[model samples]
Target: MKAAAFDYAVPKSIAEATALLGSNGAATAAIAGGQSLLPMLNLRVALPDLVVDLGRLEELKEIAATRTNIRVGALTTHAAIEDGKLPEAFGGLMQKVASKISYRAVRNHGTIGGSVALADPAADWPGCLLALGAQ
Candidate 1:
């Protein structure tokens, strides 16, 4: 089944996005990669009246590596991690885990944050991230 009709918003900043979400509350859904959310939407498991897309939020798509930490933004795709675009501080573990996420097609569209948020029992990222002591 296809998703029901819904309003959409592309917030330019995290503050705007959060405000939108806060106002919409139960009626809204935040869409980053949409890999996990879209399927649920299609199956009617999620029937949000509004979808707040974070696609235009460039800051959320970033992967910043510091001397002591690697900051992965909420919208960073698994494919980026698999492609070695993230900080080398992660060593090879992130790529190894990313390569094992379902398939290349899914990895290309799925965000690490989205994967963790879903908290699928069988998901690889969550376990790997946990083992790596990620916050």
Candidate 2:
């Protein structure tokens, strides 16, 4: 399983990364930690012509608490949340889910957005997110 040839670039912001993706068309992909994307690429499940790294996007890495609800950034790592670094409302829940994630290594690399995007029914957070109305 070999991945297709592709161009790689780390964008400083989401706007720049989105621009790269738009320019690269449907074959483009945004890679965060790459722990998941690399395996998909190797298995030939994905063959992007452009890989826009979102790891450097500070805005997407933030986890903040607002009046409406707690905000888990798209690129926020499971480990970060698991380490009790998130808001008080989500702190215990994050730890519970983080402990049961695929694995500690994968959890460290996985993200809230990645899990949500995959929409895997068996994923732990889906049920909780749904029950708690975590939009």
Candidate 3:
């Protein structure tokens, strides 16, 4: 797991992260939880010169219900979504999906954003999310 020297920042707001991305153009990237990206970095598949960690962005940790849908923050982890503390609107789908995720340990840390961002044709969540019309 080798990585090159790079600049790292824990941006408290989306504006700061946006500024970092804009300044560096494609050389910068956003990382939440760093589970997948860390492995990619170790394998040398990505080489972002700057990583804007959004771990401290409390505004992005929301899981709220709208009139017709559940609005999950892009950074919300699977565990949070499956916490079973959500309003009745979600219909236990989150919990079902959460339990069937890769593994309990991984489900705890894996974010929904990571699943969709993977863009993998064979990912487990993709089927369920698509079946639920969550694209």
Candidate 4:
């Protein structure tokens, strides 16, 4: 199915993105990775007047490691987690969970943020995130 016509924007920063979303309000949808949102858009389940693409925000793709915590960016893909890119503090729990999410295609492009945001009952990340006490 063809997706509904919509305006698209790639915001360079979180502030700009938030401003765009706020301006569009109910008519805008933020897109990152597009693994989940693409399917929904194609299925006509999500019809937004404006689709804000956050994929270009490099800051959001960063996975910073700290002494006490590992801060994962919104665009951190399942493949990155599975490849052991995150810190060892988690004891490989996220890697194990990431490896188990759907298939390789999904793993390569699907992100932790998207999975958690979608919160599908069958999605694995939500359970893992909750178990890990992630916010």
Candidate 5:
């Protein structure tokens, strides 16, 4: 099935996205890579009145690492992790997990934030992140 009709917005900044979401209330949905949300939208499981695309927000795509901590941006793709784009501090754990999520196509567009936000019991990232003491 195809998704129901909905308006789409591509916000330039986090604040703009937040305002869009708040203005629309419960009828709004935010999409990053759309790995999880797209399927639900197509199946009519998520019929949001508006979809705020966060893909182009550069702030959400950053990655920073310190001596003892690492901050991964929400828009980071699984393919990036699988391809060793992250700092070596993780000891290849994230790489191994990213390689195993569905398939290459999905990994190319799927994001760590999307996976975690879905909170699917069978999903890999959330449990892995939780176990690693992710904040």
Candidate 6:
């Protein structure tokens, strides 16, 4: 099934993205890598009036790590982790989990934030993050 008609926006910055998301009231959906969302949209499972694409938000793609903590941006893809793009301090747990999420095409487009935010019990990222006590 095709998605219901919806408007789409690509904001230049995080603030702009938030503003666009707020403009559509409760009918707004934020799309990053679109791995999970695209399927839902195509299946009409998510009928948002507007889709605010977060792909251009570079801040959401950052990764920073310190002695005490690691901050992974929401837009970080599974493929990145699988390819050892993240800090080595993580001990390869993330890489192992990322490599096991579906296939390479999905991993290339599926994001950690999308997986965790979707809150699917069977999703790997959320369980792994939870086990690691991620904030």
The candidate that achieves the highest lDDT relative to the unseen native structure: 5
lDDT of 4 by residue, 1-135 (tens): 999999999887899998998987888988887888999999999999999998888898899977778899989999999998888677788888989888898889988888888889998988888888887
**Per-model CA lDDT versus the true structure:** 0.88, 0.81, 0.75, 0.88, 0.91, 0.90
TM-score of each: 0.92, 0.88, 0.84, 0.94, 0.95, 0.95
Q: Tens digit of lDDT per residue, candidate 2, span 42-79?
A: 99898888888888788888888887788878888878
Give the candidates in order of TM-score, highest first: 5, 6, 4, 1, 2, 3
Model 3 spans with C-alpha error above 4 angstroms:
88-90
Q: For all the candidates, what are their Cα RMSDs to the real structure?
A: 1.3, 1.8, 2.1, 1.1, 1.0, 1.0
CA shift at 60, candidate 5, in angstroms?
0.9
Candidates 5 and 6 compared by lDDT, better number:
5
Query: Between which residue pairs do clashes occur in model 3?
Result: none
Clash pairs for candidate 5: none
Candidate 3 lDDT (Cα, whole model)?
A: 0.75
Give the higher-lDDT candidate: 3 or 6: 6
Candidate 2 Cα errors over 4 Å, as ranges: none
lDDT by residue (17-79, candidate 5, tens digit) is 999999888799989889889999999999999999999998887889998988999999999
- Regions of model 5 farther than 4 Å from truth: none
* Per-residue lDDT over 1-135 for candidate 6, one digit per residue giving the tens place of the 0 to 100 score: 788899999999999998998898879998988988899999998999999999878899999999999899999999998998879676789999999999999999989989988888889988899889899
Q: Is candidate 2 or candidate 4 better by lDDT?
A: 4
- Please, what are the lDDT tens digits per residue for candidate 3 over residues 48-108? 8998887788877787887888767777887776777455455677688777777767767
lDDT of 1 by residue, 44-106 (tens): 999999999987798888888878889998788989999998876666989888888888899
- Please state the error at residue 67 of candidate 2 in Å: 4.2
